[model samples]
Target chain A: MPVQLAIALTHLLSRKRQTLVSLTGIVLGVAFFLAVSSLMRGSEGDFIKRLIDNSPHITVSDEYRQAQRQPASERWPTGAVELRRVKPLTEVRGIRGHPRALAYIESLPGLRAAPVLVGSVVLTFAGRIEGVTLNGIVPDKMKQVSTIEDKMIEGSLEQLAANPNGIVIGAGLARKFGLAMGSVVNAASPGGEVRTLKVVGIFRTGNANYDDMQTFALLKRAQGLLDRPNRINRIVIQLSDPYAAREVASIIERGIGYKAVSWLEASEDLMSVLLVRNLIMYSVVSAILVVAAFGIYNTVSTIVMEKIHDIAILKSMGFHARDIRLIFLTEGVILGLIGSLFGLTLGLGLMALLARVELKPPGATELVFLPIYWGYEQYLLAAGFAMASAIGAAWLPARKAGRVQPVVILRGMG
Target chain B: MNPAGREGSPPMLTAERLGRVLPGEVPVTLVQDISLTIDRGEFVAIMGPSGSGKSSLLYLLGLLDTPTAGRILLDGRDTSGYGEDELATTRLRQLGFVFQFHFLLAEFSALDNVLLPMRRLGALDEGSAQRRAGALLAQLGLDGQAHKRPHQLSGGQRQRVAIARALANDPPIILADEPTGNLDSHAAANVRQILRDLTRELGKTVIAVTHDLTFASAADRQIGIVDGRIDPHWRA
Candidate 1:
């Protein structure tokens, strides 16, 4: 072994109690850092997964991002043509030539698009009335772009194809109206058209508000009741890779000349909240390691003080200042390495314990295990930060040891 | 006893008007205007009262401390331009030191203590260095105590281990600062004889600082210092 490292080991071994205490500090710090970070990151990942799974990756609405230019302004270049208080053209309220837009959207790779007509309607049955959102859908196309099929408790979306006037109501709506799978209800649109629709499907989405106020029916039947034909106001898109939503949404908006909002864009405020939460979590955990580094500084500094005479002897025997410095630095490094190894093992154990814990959230029906992310980067980060702290703690005492003057020490002895 | 060097060869160590001062608001002079030379294979003693700067002069000569006013020449080479690292290397390869105290690292065994300089110099492989440390310990009559730490050994044995360490790198000059100050009479005599034999039998230069007149009498020449200057009247 090198002389410096050998001396470092000897110094640490001689102070067993102090060394062990400092080592334990590092171990606990690292273990806690890993466990807490894993939980935070795991929950964040789970939340994002649920968000992406339940909503459309992109929603292309039949609206322009900017107001349309008048034809006079388009025709005259550099002409003095400022127009004020000129009434805008009133046009139809739905996407024009939506079939062509749908075709263009479906041509893109890795996505499925379905056109939807949505309007508010009043349902009446047995001297009871309730207002609900009515969504007009092509059942075959809708299944490809929606998760409503997964939430079905009674009939399937395919039943709407079999029964032309069928509508799917939420479980809350069914309970409120005392309706069965084959019950009939009168749905009246704001445009004064009415139709009697049968309840063919009931779904429970675990969201009380959505379950109470949303209903779906076939596109033909909804158009007949709502008095609007061949119109769709929204195109919902699902992507194979949800993370590509922002890019795909922009491309769709450019192609269809409408406003497309990606799920990421729509939930940007929540994303920022998650980012700030992570920053706070990492800083809080890193503070533990920083506190542990102080333990190392104390231990190493004591060793340097106790070994002052030995330092004088070594210097007089021609050991360089850097060699003296290296001895103490080596002590810190050894402590860091050993502590990280044990800490990581203990952290894995903690993560395993956390992953096995089962708890039911408030208002939740089922028990869920705590999520723990076992990513390799967190391990690397923990170990790297620990080593840096150890080295940093050792630097000051090592430098002091190297600067010892042998003549002064020997004269003092005399 | 040759006060001047041998006729054909340069002196092993030379100091020309060497001076050292501790800087402060009121500066203190530890050593001043000192000039000396010692030949190869000579035994010399520097005798002085307390605070007379003999240890400070020894430190300057060993290159353990820099001289503030004048230069030191080791084997005819001017060392004025050497940096701290160069000085340390020069000391490692060319000079050895033994102090008033044993100063052996308490955690290391006697053999390991002797091996420190050889390992730092890296002039020998590990096997050769270990063998040489063992040989030096045995030569100093410390064969049985080679594996003992300083705290486990007697005072005389610890000093002998320190002497062995001084000879570890086989430097031409060995500087001793009160090498036998802490020993009993018998141990002091034994250490004195061993230092004498180093010059006579092994052809090594040995310079020692001592207050013991009996110990100083063993050397061929004695240089006395009063108030940091050489005093010709105060001799052994």
Candidate 2:
């Protein structure tokens, strides 16, 4: 088999000039697969990670009864779902003696829940502070659901714990205030009372929303500032299977008075954007693949016609039509395999280069990084699609060439 | 002796009232009633001017074209009902063809050109195919030229490689369409000798089409075709 392939390859390689067009097409198809697919799937994975980080994956928050009647942007932010707000009973509800009520929510059949206090507050850091959203969080549980630990740029949990008046600033916020680790910050809590804290940590969420206009502190500290020691703004729950969120949320809601909302329901805008982006990428790139497939067909057919006389000679010499077809088909597969593999290498190179590119949203608004990412399945899908199109393109031409007769060819195209 | 039962005289190719009329608004009849039989070992030449249907007739005989009104028998099976695959099978295993020009693949070497037939047939393994190509090339005094492309070879050398290609399957019948038409006299003569040797020494039937009288005169039998009909006076 190897020797046969060698001979076949040698024959094809000899005719490089004639076959080059099709090979180039295949390479282009492969490049499309790698580039577009990487962006789509890469963005998909990133979107999911971001959604989980910045927003609650499952929320029991305040719901407004006449949400649909209200202007969409009123109760919910422009990008959030227009959900009715049903205020939760904020008094600390517990399982064990611990003041964590979410521990009870997490203990349900299959759930992991976190308690949080979120609100906008006026902040002062080195006399250069601004108004930012205060994300009051349970330090231990926040790390589980998000990459908080990995994102921290300055100070440690011990340092944060040591200062009873401690707060963690976003890296952007720290920069804005000209503050550093051990610096102090002051904020008007949710209830409009003043609160001050030492800067124990700094974080960069790889996203401007969290990094620019956000600040974090211990849940206990948040309770003190808000003048609601036993209350929380929201409780977040994560199920064993994310797809079962809506049903699980309902069950939890029936048992508790709070409105339970799944991430899909709450983050509809984000999901749609991510989905549309992927679809667009696939569609645009597929148009390129279609052209490449035609290129393969054109290349194979022309090569077959060019070799008609040779085909006749081979046919007369006891060569089967199937054998002729196989040779051409193999050539097609080879083109796809070579092109895709090369494209993958090229894609990775481009990815590495793009990774270093820090995009600033094309305007005065500044952003640190241009977002892109890909997981294993995305790469496989790209290569798979490329191979399918390439092989499919060659099939017809191979068959046509195989069935050519030695006599007609010898007669010289009559 | 009944001609049909002559001992040691098996017909390798037989055609009965073969005709082909392509479908169209008005069907065009390419060839009319034509009947002929070729024996196992004979060198026959077809002589005709342009549009005399010589090539078309050759195409039908070689299983490359369909007959509108007749049956073709290979060794004896009627070809009227044969499908595309069946025709391809007969062409692959039982016949060989050489054209006026040596249509050797420009991309392949002499050896690969000879082995091309075997590759298409997928019958002979690579080792045997190489061995057979090598022997045929050497027989035509082209062993040293096996590594060269058709373009690199002199006309005569390339024609010899083509002849080797024709003999690749050891088919019983060989077809030639102006085999010497494109070569110089020396190359043409060499091709003629090779065709003649295929019949005389290897016990194969050979048909050649040509306008070259010198080449036609050398054949054991000759048929002159005029306006798609064979002339009675020059039928043999």
Number of the top-ranking candidate, with DockQ as the measure: 1
DockQ metric for all predictions: 0.75, 0.43
Candidate 1 fnat reads 0.71
In candidate 1 the C-alpha lDDT for residue A8 amounts to 95
Which residue pairs show collisions in model 1?
A: none
Model 1 segments beyond 4 Å from truth? A76-92, A122-132, A151-154, A169-188, A192-199, A202-214, A360-365, B1-7
Candidate 2 lDDT over B40-106, as tens digits, reads: 7878888877877777777788887888787888777787898877877787688887766777778
Residue-level lDDT tens digits of model 2 in A348-390: 7776776677766522235645455657776677678778887
What CAPRI class is candidate 2? acceptable
Indicate the DockQ of the complex predicted as candidate 2.
Answer: 0.43
